[model samples]
Target: MGVIKGIEHVGITVPSIEAAERFFQQAFGAKTLYALIEKGGKSQEGDEMYDKNGLEPGTRIIAMRMMRIADGANVELFEVEGGHGATADAPSHMGIHHFALYVDDLEEAAARFRDAGGTMREGPIELGGKEKGPGNRCWFGVAPWGMQVEFIHLPSPIALDDQASSGPRWLPG
Candidate 1:
């Protein structure tokens, strides 16, 4: 195996790429970086690739739209055409469950997300302890595409410890 770089971006499946583009702009202050409509391209989970193949006479992904969270990573949206492939939804499918983003101000981030029609699922978890360490973490209600996003404020650099089974138990401090 090779050393891995950080996450580049996440792709999301949408019925309408245009709708997703608009929603990201309005809801999360995301900006559109690039978009293209490939008449005949390789079909991906969110993309519709069209070609005259064995299964169908001609099947393909007609269009795709990609947006980014400001200067951050991007979210590629695909608008697949029928007969190309079946579109899968969240829960059962194997895709991105949530992308964790680090923010400076938790209050402001939450407010902005909510004001822009976002819903909050988890809370401002004060993450700090001798064992757990210090930080703030929470999960967004849902993205415009119904995907979950997490906002975390880490006090210090930390990594997940697989050996650490249970958290420190409180003894009525």
Candidate 2:
């Protein structure tokens, strides 16, 4: 099998593309790369396709914006006019729990997030020693639309030991 490359982007469904774009830009200095709009119809075939994809029939993708966050990954923010899904309130729910961004200054990042109307959900906690060493810290914030965002500061990447579990090495630190 071919080896997989790194992640290119993460898609996030938001209530409003404009608001999400603004939040990302203000909080993380994310820049918009592109935008798109997808139209939906109520035809039988269209409805079937939408239903198969867990979307409401005739649901339209109102707007979508691809944003680049600092020097890390890209985030694709989508605004669907009609979708048959609900946002998960907590990280324990079975789905994409949250997305994290790395920052040099944890306090500054948290302040920017708060200034952008995001609520601090948890932590300005430390993770040292066996967890991820002395230089790592993190905090979680929720956007106005209830999307969870994590801000982390790690001056050095953690080196996994032989006893480490099989998962994303960059995560859970």
Best by lDDT: 2
- What's the number of clashes in each of the models? 12, 0
Least lDDT summed over 10 consecutive residues: which range in candidate 2? Answer: 86-95
TM-score, model 2 to reference: 0.74
**How close is every model to the real structure, measured as TM-score?**
0.62, 0.74
Which predicted model would earn the best TM-score? 2
What C-alpha lDDT do the candidate models reach, one value each? Answer: 0.58, 0.69
Cα deviation of 4 in candidate 1 (Å)? 4.6
- Cα lDDT tens digits for candidate 1, 90-140: 211323667766677678877777776677776777665532455545546
**lDDT of model 2 at position 109:** 88
Instruction: Give the deviation of candidate 1 from the true structure as CA RMSD.
Output: 8.1
